[model samples]
Target: MATVNLDLTPIHQCSADGCTFNASASCHAPAITVGDHGANHCATFLGIPTKHSPTNDGHVGACQLSDCSHNADLTCTASTIEVGTSAGGGTECLTYSAA
Candidate 1:
C-alpha cells in the first residue's frame, strides 16, 4: 500500500497578522486564496481595508494557520477552514483537523 506523509507545520504557524480571521493563533475564516509574488489581496480577508483583483489558483491554496494540523498529503480533517493574508498581501486557507 502507498503511504502518504503530511506536514502540519505551516498550518500551525500562519504568517498573517492583519487578517481579522486570525485570533489567538487560530484562524476563523471560511476560505482563503494566494497570489503571485506581486498579485492582489484576497477579498474574503476581513479588515483588509483594501480591494484588488483575485489571484490565480497556481499561487492559491487552503490556509494552514491556527490549530490546523493538515498533513503533507493535503488531507484536512478540520470541520471549518479559515482565510488569512500572506506575506505579500496574498490569501491563504487555514485548515485544521481534529486530533
Candidate 2:
C-alpha cells in the first residue's frame, strides 16, 4: 500500500465517541472525508469498536460540500474543524458554513 501526504486542515475536536478515530475528544485518523452522499456529514465516521492509532493526527482530506465556504476545489480549507453527532443520527462537521 502507498500513502499520500497532503497539507490538510486539522480536526480540532471530535465528540463522536462511537467513531474509531476519536481519542479523548480528538480525531486520530490520518484523514477524514466530509459531505458524503451529497450531505454535510462526516463520511469517514465509523461506529465500530476498537480505536485506531492515537499517534495518527486527523485532518480534513476532502469535502463534498461544494456550497460550503470552507471548501476549496473539493478540499476543506478551514484552519480547523469539529466533528460531532448530528440531530439526524449521523456525524457531521460543525464548522460548516454557507458560502
Q: Please name the candidate that would achieve the greatest TM-score relative to the true structure.
A: 2
Cα lDDT listed for each candidate: 0.40, 0.88
TM-score of each: 0.31, 0.90
Error of 2 at 94 (Å): 0.3
What TM-score should be assigned to candidate 1?
0.31
Name the weakest run of 10 consecutive residues (lDDT summed) in model 1: 51-60
lDDT of 1 by residue, 4-99 (tens): 223222234334666555555454333344222323334445666442332211122333333335433333444334445545656655342432
Clashing pairs in 1: 6-71, 6-72, 7-71, 7-72, 11-64, 33-91, 62-93, 63-93, 63-94, 78-96
Which digits, one per residue and each the tens of the lDDT, describe model 2 over residues 1-99? 335365789899999999998999999888889997779899899888988768756899889999899999998888899999988878999999999
**Alpha-carbon deviation at 79 in model 2, angstroms:** 0.7
